[model samples]
Target: MQINPPGTVQEQRPDALTKYLQHRLAQRDREGNLRRLPQPTTGIDFWSNDYLGLAAGAAATGEGTALPCGATGSRLLSGNSQQALDLESFLAAHHNQEAALLFNSGYDANLGLLSVLPNRHTVVLYDEYCHASMLDGIRLSPVKQAFRFRHNSAEDLEQKLRRYAQPGTPVLIALESVYSMEGSIAPLAAITGLAARYGAAVVVDEAHATGIFGAGGTGLVQQLGLEQQVTARVHTFGKALGCHGAAITGSRLLIDYLVNFARSFIYTTALPAQAIDAIARAYRYIGEQPALVVQLHDLVSYFRQQLQERGLRGWCDSITPIQSLLTGGNAATRSLAGRLRSQGISVSAVLSPTVPLGRERLRICLHAFNTRGEIDLLLNLLSSCPNPDL
Candidate 1:
């Protein structure tokens, strides 16, 4: 092999890197799928994950003065504080688990849990539509045998389990309580039942379901009384809770293992006291007013009814607040999203490679704060559109 000559840049040089990146972005631009930061607007609320309108609450105005400004280090370092410990304790009790371990965000929690815990001999079976974070964790793990079953199909999951499971190998089934992009829920009870027969541990990422389903906003796993059956549940603070960070609730042994093995947890700085305060406040608020969840569900029901009355096609059928209108291609979906924005409505265009090609969609997030008139106007706009069939 020949070495580089004097002043000759290597293949990994900055010029080479910039060229490759520019090429990829040019390809996206050609497909009409170039991504950019959206300008903030005071449009109708139909795109944010602030399910309970808690983000606009008094907490954002700095209502509490007890929280520290920053976390100095990782949880294993100076970042570990009494307040963080208390919040974890509160989470454990609320979720009906033996312990709770906190992470800076939902992505961190998933990465830490899946990447560090599973071994080369451990078999991981995930849903086909699990979140990108969970998929990333699996990709980075040493896990040797991992497969995905059809989304929400417990029968297919059982088939996979029967095929790969052995007498001594440890198995784990990963799922989301609600698949974020598709706005569909998993068959938790049935999947857990299958896991039980195979002696597999079941882990659920309840990022979208938290603070919207279970008693006192615990999550869907606890709402169905499957808390005892699930091996672990990852609850996030961003979606319905209107805050930041995430937690993994499970047996004390599991948390202990993660505390030791999770590189994302051990190497990174922890969530600040302010985020912890916001989470605690949100949980307390929901505990006092469980009707907020009911109100959100009612809105979800009304939106579904509106879709049916308008004969709207491509909307996902679910009682959940997330509703996606499949538009088949990126350019088309972006056009619809732009039209909605021009009409003072906010909606998200779910495009590729976040989703597969031919599956681009306009995702609408319903909330307790939306009004009947807002939903009606959105429906009317869609009904009069020139090409929803696009």
Candidate 2:
């Protein structure tokens, strides 16, 4: 046996685990879908979730000034603070809910809620395009069964609810108010109607809709007058709010239940004081500047009009800040993104297996800060590009 010096680290050759990992990565590389972290770049804003420009603006306001950097411990322990509690109260009122529970991010909120809410007899029927976090949460649960309905299709959801939902058994319906990829708005009224008829609880992920919709950015659930119909609503701050973390709004009983049973919330360290303060400031800022939301909507309308005037077709139907244009195949979608980036425009290309294999698209996000001239420049390039390989 060979031995090394006492302080020297051992060097080992590649093992089966290393080879397996390499093989998986190689497969993805061959498929033209290898994922990599992108370097930060500056240009016209067309790719971020910051719809209201609050992230930079709030930072300029010194929202998190002179605060601690870390939470110290989990919320169940020494991490909990009075500031957190006060912020929760403010969020509850802002969202028109009896109570609100905070989580580190939208993923954690969804995972924590879905994993605990379902029992062995509970059935979860979710939209096909629901976020991966929601799907992972359902997978972690002890729910009786889970099924995917067509994306934004009330008829398909109703069919599954009719077939699978049994009498006296709890049924959880999951969907997003505004889809991140497709930029399509959910038919909340029709879905809520079905939920009421079948006695199912609706859980709406208002991540993309939270900071851009409703009066004072309350979200689509409130904008459409469906707050009372929703059992729970998850609003993420990293998007349009220009902050970080997320909150689940619901009945006081629901908040209490999650506090006791949700492992993600119970086990993880709470958000730091700085984050909590920033969230509060963001809300206050939006409340004071209602015109920000109006400006964003006006920009959305302008974008659509430009697309029509340019006679550019194939853009997905969307009335929100998130807009997608389908450019099928990984090579084609990535090529399109490269072309845009070359022109000093920052945009994201959604490729498989994020979406289905043939459903690759370019996800373009609009913001209150974006100008019509910048939008026209983006559209001019898009109109000139050749058709993508499907």
Candidate 3:
């Protein structure tokens, strides 16, 4: 037997950049975490973020579909349309904020907000489990330091605040209303109360809570009655509202501050008027069809009750529509998701790097349109999920 080391078949061909990317891709494939665009399907819709069943709504239209496909330039340039302004104003009043500034996406809104509001003299405190966008923003900001508090632990957050407390230095505490991955709601009341006592500013991202929780889907922040205490609330229309774009709601002065200093907001092209109309349609739908929200809550309750009936209530920690079931490994999680898909169901497995190792799980997003029978079927499948490793 000829004993030769690896790489005996071919000489290296890719350049440095391509080789680097190839290595990364190879590693991801080995880990079963290589992501690809998903194919369209008619499977049961349990994998999407369309919590309010609004993404399937009609596309924006008026007299015709002849509206321009894009706004063509940044908002500071020629792209700020009257339609966009009207939506922003409506968002401001509806959310009980002094003003609102629209961003092209939730990512841009978080990046812009964090980049502008903090300086070298500021201490940034954030939940360890906050979204990647928020953490990325904090990483890219000019703030000299940032501290992490344990997820949903107000006591740990207060400890961070105390550790960073100093004279003349502003403290910024950021968190999500509902964490996207684990589907757990934050202790907003406790966290905000801690911020108030420490004289820290609070910035909340309400991406997952929009159009599902508060009065007419105002959001969890408004529902908790801490609207005035929080410094800024970033609400996105893409998740529950099933539209595109995000809004930064706060005082008029804060809006002015971001408009002048936030590079992400200043440098990007504005969203199209048609997209703004879609957002308006979603808001109007929520306002007129209050029964949808009620139905969603009921569905969530029913799902939880079913979980309890199956002796699985302690498996997950979420009360809202977003729920997850832990599977312990990447291959196992994907195997479970594949089993569901093979049976005409659509569900996604959260793999490693997105979540910690050995904590891979299935993220199940519930909608108002999911029937009781569908829920029962899904639970039955989950109950009987086999050992893929076998």
| Highest lDDT against the true fold, candidate | 2
**RMSD per model, one decimal:** 17.4, 17.9, 18.3
In Å, residue 251's CA in model 1 sits off its true spot by: 0.4
TM-score to true structure, per model: 0.83, 0.83, 0.82
Model 1 stretches with alpha carbons more than 4 Å out: 1-66, 388-390
Instruction: For model 1, state the Cα shift of residue 263 in Å.
Output: 0.7
Candidate 1 per-residue lDDT, tens place, 1-390, comes to 121222221122122212333455567678885443223235576654445544444256656345455565677755676778888888887887778999989999999888866677788999989898899999899898999999899999989999988876778899999989888989988998888788787889999999998777878887787776787799999999999999998776567667766788888877777888999999999989888888899999899887777777887767799998889888888889999999999999999988888878889999998988999998899888877562
Q: What is the C-alpha local distance difference test score of each model? A: 0.80, 0.82, 0.79
Q: Number of clashing residue pairs in every model?
A: 0, 0, 0
Model 2 lowest lDDT segment of ten = 1-10
Estimate, for each residue in 81-190, the C-alpha lDDT of model 2 and write its tens digit.
Answer: 77888888888877877789999999999999998777777789999999999999999998868999999999999999889877777788999999999899999999
Native-referenced Cα lDDT, model 3: 0.79
RMSD of 1: 17.4
Itemize residue pairs with steric clashes in candidate 1.
none
Ranking by lDDT: 2, 1, 3
lDDT tens string, model 3, 334-390?
888999999999998899989988778888999999999999999888888765421
